[model samples]
Target: MSTVSTPGEPQARSKPPIEAVPVRHPGRWVGVGIVAIFAAMLVHSLLTNPNWGWSLISEWIFAPPIVKGVGVTLLLTFLSMIIGLALGVLLAIMRLSPNPVMSGSAWVFVWAFRGTPVYVQLFLWANVIALYTTLSLGIPFGPEFFTFETKTLIPAFVAALLGLGLNEAAYMAEIVRAGILSVDEGQEEAATAVGMSRLQTLRHIVLPQAMRVIVPPTGNETISMLKTTSLVIAIPLTTELFFQASAVGNRLFQPFPMAILASIWYLALTSILMVGQFYIERYYAKGAMRELPPTPIQKWRRRLGRGGSND
Candidate 1:
């Protein structure tokens, strides 16, 4: 059945399509503008400033002495971290041992090293010959089979290592302990139930899990060790980066620019360490995360794909 339309009746109308407006974040844009202004100011200052001695910095940054100094710095960082990590693991195990003597000894060692300043420790090691002119190897308080001069035994480099490595060991012990403690107690119990020995359980079960906790701080400590190599100057050891830069400054009568150069090198080395740390952390995160975060290359590929699709 058809209905007849009334004269002068309004015609049926369709509603207009809804407009979808995105929510605006004005504050975010304001914050970005503020940051950009500050960054521009900083860049402007770096470019315009005449006193920075950018020419001198470029000239000496790759100089032979500076290059050698960087090598020494890297060597010191690697060797010191090795000593610290190895000794720290032993100390941490001792600290967690059932025997009171082992735990007590570990505690005392950590306390002594952590209590003293590193500079003082370096100084003492440098002058250790004052206290022990000769060191002998044999039965304690009995006839010695061999003796050696302390001066010949402990060079300035060795003294720096002793100071830095020993001091770092104390700190690393605490970090290792924290990482060990972060593991679930039930994991160890399950390992024991499987007939694993204490050492085997710790090695296969506990330490592997603990590494997730341990690696981040250990990386940070590695970077700190790189910088702390500067304090070897207190041992009057002159082969490291900072000392070399300072020597160059004194020679050229341009101390401030040389200091800046040292800082730039330190920053560059630290950035490399940070990249390594990121990858290490990502590796350890595999078991913990259901899906790992994208790497830089993956992200770049994704962005390029999106851009091509849009085009």
Candidate 2:
């Protein structure tokens, strides 16, 4: 069909077809560079390893009481962290509150906990002779039935629990605060526009978005809390991982090896937590990464490739 426009008639121009822009994957050089670095690291590790052909890994793993005591350490770490997480969230809210009294109370709690040596805090908790001298709540056998015995109430383990968990909460409150604040302000506004309450917006919208920023430090805190539980052995009532290991080491006169064994278990435990961190971070990032960020190389590749297309 030849439909040419006359000289006096207007000519119609065809619009350009929309094309799919291909994403620029990294070049072969990047993969080669990464492989070279990894190989160099592996070679260095092999060359510098203290034991080339032998291992005490089996002996380290099979130690009976040490293995069991690790369970206790894990228990203490997990329990305290659970408690600390709740306490931290509360304190974080209070610290960020508009009310002066609430914020001041939070500040005082953190100041006292972080100011004192944790060792001192543990000791004070273990010997918690009296939280308060007076029993203001009730009478022994009168109209008020409730009573708390000064001597019987505060046990050493309970004291240790309070000290470690509360101390951890103070540190974690700051971490939570920072994580919450790191969320974009626009998210809150959008959530509000959608008719969500402030609390609702914070819980469902802000916190979910802030997970990537929060997870790394929270993982570190978990590992730190695991090690910190060893301090509970000072109460002399219960045995933590280090306590059990140190006892056996002192008896056997293989103090160095036993201590090393304890450290190895701790590192293993922490490594597991680190792996969990990667998965958790990825889970949180899945939705966030829907709009992928263009890397620097991707930008340059696109710019360079555009030249070829234009030509």
Candidate 3:
């Protein structure tokens, strides 16, 4: 008996299998180059500017008004962020409102605030010598109108606060809207089906879930707002941190070191904010833990289960 394969039988090839050649991302090389350039520039600049020496550093760092200014900066950053966050939440809800008037009003507010330059907005607000400027309180038509002069009613600091806080609110609103929308619609539906009111559902379920999305960017915004508050110097408020620093620098003619010192404070504040963001993100992600992609063992176990069921 001859051992022969049929004519239609398939033949197997014995060639070695090829593996993928690893590719390094261009971004890594770009990042490395940037670090190298940054290091070189830093070294060169530091070496050339030996006068930012210990004494000058200590003096500027310990200056009474500058020290006080740091406190003011913190106060302003905290107050403005709180104001912005509250406004952001309200604006986001308004933007998502079913009523055309509310939605349109929110849209116009965001568009005007975000579309214009923030610095210009600050300056315009500072110059609020508008005719018939009343010390309006409450809603547009909620009825209590105690009028006062614009200049008397709106101080430079108040104007600056309103400008930056309101402007920040616009950007923050979009961020909040995106964050809330990213949450599963089912969550809201579940709350509704459970007999939760819209406000209650939003306050509890939607907000908790949405927080995971918002916290990170909100932290970043807080950090950015710290630096941005420097723009308040245009309003000529000397109590804020940068203003005091600039005053010292102007008098001493050491603007370079003074500016660098101010930059250092900004860096410090932002670094703290970054750490805060990390913790907040971790906290918000508690319910979102998912097992990572399957390993070989997992793959085989799943396959076996499927195959056994097929039997």
What total of clashing residue pairs does each candidate reach? Answer: 0, 0, 0
**After aligning candidate 3 to the native by TM-score, how far in Å is the CA of 83 from where it should be?**
1.2
Best by lDDT: 1
Model 2 misplaced stretches (Cα beyond 4 Å)? 1-61, 130-144, 150-152, 290-311
TM-score of each: 0.91, 0.70, 0.76
Q: Kindly report the root-mean-square deviation of model 2 from the true structure over all alpha carbons.
A: 9.1
lDDT of 2 by residue, 49-156 (tens): 754311443465567788888998898888888878889888988998899999999999999998887778887776666565434365546565555764466666
Every model: Cα RMSD to truth: 6.2, 9.1, 9.8
lDDT of 1 by residue, 1-311 (tens): 33456667658544455668867889989999999999999999998898899999999999999999999999999999999999999999999999999999999999999999999999999999999999999999999999999999999999999999999999999999999999999999999999999999999999989999999999999999999999998889999999999999999999999999999999999999999998999998868899988889998899898886532
Model 3 CA lDDT for position 181: 99
Q: After superposition, how far is residue 227 of candidate 2 from its true place, in Å?
A: 1.2
